[model samples]
Target: MDKRYVRAAVIALMLAGLTLHGGIASAQQKRDTIRIGFVTFLSGPAAGPFGVPARMAAEAVVEQLNAGKAPAPYDTKGFGGTPIELVVIDEAGGTTKQVSEFRNLVSRQNVDYVIGYISSGDCLAIAPVAEEMKKVTVLFDCGTPRVFEEASYKYVFRTRPHATMDAVAAALYLLEQKSGVKSYGGINQNYAWGQDSWHDFDLAMKTLKPDARVTTSQMPKFGSGQYGAEISALIQSGSEVIHSSLWGGDLEAFMMQSVPRGLFRKSQLVLVAGEPYLHRLGANMPDGTIVGARGTHGVFAPDSNLNTWLKTIYKAKAGHDPNYPAYVATLAFLGLKTAFEKAKLEQASSLKPSDDALIATFEGLSFDSPSGRATMSLGKGHQAVMGTAYGTTKLVNGKVTVTNVKHYPAERVTPPNGISSPDWIKGGMKPGK
Candidate 1:
């Protein structure tokens, strides 16, 4: 009695299966946009300084690239005429959360690539995972030298020079600017980024001033917000100069806490990653303080067509000039764009290029950026090297201005390829002449 009913049910199931297959096939063939897994600290102490600016810059750059508004060499509409859609993820939680987030981005969301990580801890956690997954990942910020020195990954690359350059350039600037340079110490946040920065600076200072004593060194946890004890220790330790590579809200909080205690007034303060908060610090940034932007960023950025265009859009988005983090993020996008377009042009047959093809194009690739030209000349072309600049701050007409600026070449600051920063610094650090 149910023979006709059974046949009707079989036909209905077959039709449904066919419809699903057609839908899946259309999704695979008609997809014209590539999704990028963009991770940053959307909500955290680091958001205002590092994460927000980086996200803003990324949005601006991707929008311009999609519109074919980017300058020459990057004028192509997105990557090989394919639009880019960002699947933004917050990087506030610890490294474990970040690793989970990374997996979800790759496996669940199916992001074509990832461009993010403003923390060295996050980068370290994500790097091996990136290699394991064979997904292209670009690190925008996070200034630890250990990422490349400790290991190598084919799918991971950094667009910004590591923290070693920040400290090396800062030390060289200090020696050149001061006469005696008797004693110095540092206060760095307790993490890979902070530890690496302090280690490099300590070695550089020891190499440069053999007799100078280290009166005090403090390692505070990131976003501690209260540095009263550290400030008191540095002040009591009789250090003549204080060097700090702290960034984000931690850096700003240190200044706010240390200035009232007369720490900046009592001792020379060198803020290696302090250029971003120049406006927030304003007159509070302290005159005669040595400030560095990590690279040629902020007021230190050169006047170029790319710089002009980027600064205009970045300002409109960020409501202020682009800082080191913002510049580094945008540069990462530019580097990605340059490599993608170049790979596409070099091979017309491969419509969707393999990871190897893009990585091959990215290796040792040099590209024009808003700040200047960036070269992936270190870590066997897995890491980038860029010139760094340091300047003294001066309050003039109620605004903080960089005075007596000095620029150091990339060769002078960065360790050579195949040499770890510690080995390079400890072994007399031979630099290019």
Candidate 2:
């Protein structure tokens, strides 16, 4: 009588063991998709030039990686089986909104990494949160030196060169190309990027041509539609050269306003972040205007292998030529790919890599970018060592293009260690006592 009941109980136990084993097997078989949080101004005046292309580039890169169609040096799948799953967040308007979004991404969404921030202020605001959360943040296009300088967060790493490098490159180009240019004026947006750009350009120009005076300085509130007041002030000051750091809608509006006012006729206009707007502005942009990307122009002119491939892929996906935003997006992913590959190697060797391992992998890691080779220095601050490209604007065949291109080495412009940009400028500007 007991044997029959015992056999039934043994069968039940066997079924339960199989069920538990199957559950564990299913969990092990599930593929882990790397989650990345991407933040940008997707709906605003700045969206068209900076945010739109950035989103497009991100999608394109992910798509290519999944499809197994991307090339080497930037090939995402080359880092083994870690496929990325991006969760995009639209940081509606300001730095405050960006900080809020960053907290949500880290605390709530629990993303593996973060990649996008076009505004300098937003990047600066979010750097602390990244450090607190212990997330790897690959900043795409925030160029203000203050982001890396004022806040020395170990988790923050920028792919683009700082504003000071952009300013130095532009200043050197203007003096080398333009003849009989003595006095210059600056018209920049009233923000950290603008302030730093003008200050650095002034310093560089003073060093290159000491007697070259900066006659007029104007910093209009960003996104201001009309630049007539600033343009008039510069004209009245009788300066022969003008430098501007306006970007996105701000730059577009400035170009539309200043071109017809005969400002270009009076002075040689130098507009940073100009290549991105070339297609949008086309013939409306003043010819012979000196303009380029902040640190490096992101286009295939004649000698860039990566730029050529990027241009083709970007145009095929978005139906437009790739700009600096595309370059930033690509660089962001490249940095991630590099770190993950290194992490994988460490994991294979029976080592448990920490978040700092990811950061250390990027330190001194160099890769060929669309513009040129970019490397990170994990010194006092995790800043990038990247080159820049500059050129003059011209409408050729109904398309805007930057001609007579010149590339500048990054080390030539980066300031020395322990020296803040503001302090360096102040020291350089001081008169002999």
Candidate 3:
């Protein structure tokens, strides 16, 4: 046989092997499971209230999706028939540790995507790394504006609105609910989320209600669990209203300590991250306390098919209603699912979509959630903007629940594209386009 003919035959055999089992084996070999790095706090102070709920939400959402029982628009089974495999990581240690875990997930575990990070610090540090590694990372509920406000990324996306909405809506809620709110003060954890929340709330107050004076401001070290000095200072300040963005154990500890000190009765308490604790804290929270669920989540979550489904399953397993953290985590997973199906369907193929395809399709994608409509309206269409809801807690029939719930539309609270939160707030916080 001629040398050329033998070489050509060998090439044909190799090509034929690539098409074995009608490309089924080849496809499976390429990618059988979609690995996702699901990062959230699983240990330490934040575990019980914040991280555990989020973890439960992830498990339920994944199980339902794999079972092909998720509500419409998200009814597709596990990223277009490819089962999802999650590598759950605890976001406990700090930003540095979280960053290291993220690289481990991407490089060692070989995750295709990442969806996690409840801390703003983690999100801020991970966003650039996500871009650098060219991986698709979805931020569930960090809320700080600094992530996208300072820089832009093609791979990093947030499925929920940032802290600006939470803080702005919080201030706007107070302005609408109260009269003669002439003075205010805050006791927030001294971290990115805390600092950002307090700053935005202060700025929004300054812009909305110019007369609202800052009687005092306190920044306690995170996880300190002791606010003796801060609470005493806030009580002495005699402010009409006291604001706090504390969440998880920190928020719980503050309420436990202050409620006994009669702080809530002395001054109106506005807990921006308080909706989850409404039931847990019960009458201890005091009636008329202002609360927000970050967005349209938890007690303020609207009635919908998606909401009912998630709530029923989550409550069954978690033994309590899914809170704001769970709701936000579900939103992130659903967003990823929506994006994956969109990218996959455009090809009309059974194979999973490419990272570039998913990224292209996800930008500016508007999708439904358990809460409501979420649009990729900010950060050059890379970040999400969702409506935020706030309400005052009322104890009725022995259960702590929100009354007088009011939702601020995404357009009203979220800054429009091409503008940062500070600029928008300074420019009068004009409604989004």
Per-residue lDDT tens digits for candidate 2, residues 156-201, read 8887667776777787788889745889999988877788788888
User: Against the true structure, candidate 3 has what lDDT?
Assistant: 0.87
What residue runs in model 1 are displaced by over 4 Å at the alpha carbon? 1-30, 349-351
* Backbone clashes, candidate 1: 0
Clashes of 2: 0
> Between candidates 2 and 3, which one is better according to lDDT?
3
Which of the two, 2 or 3, has more TM-score?
Answer: 3
Q: Can you tell me which runs of candidate 2 are displaced by over 4 Å?
A: 1-31, 76-79, 300-305, 349-353, 378-381, 423-433
Give lDDT per model, in order.
Answer: 0.87, 0.76, 0.87
Q: Each model's TM-score?
A: 0.91, 0.86, 0.91
For model 1, residues 66-175, the per-residue Cα lDDT tens digits are: 99998897888888888898888999998999999898788667788999999888998999999999999999998788899999889999988888888899999998
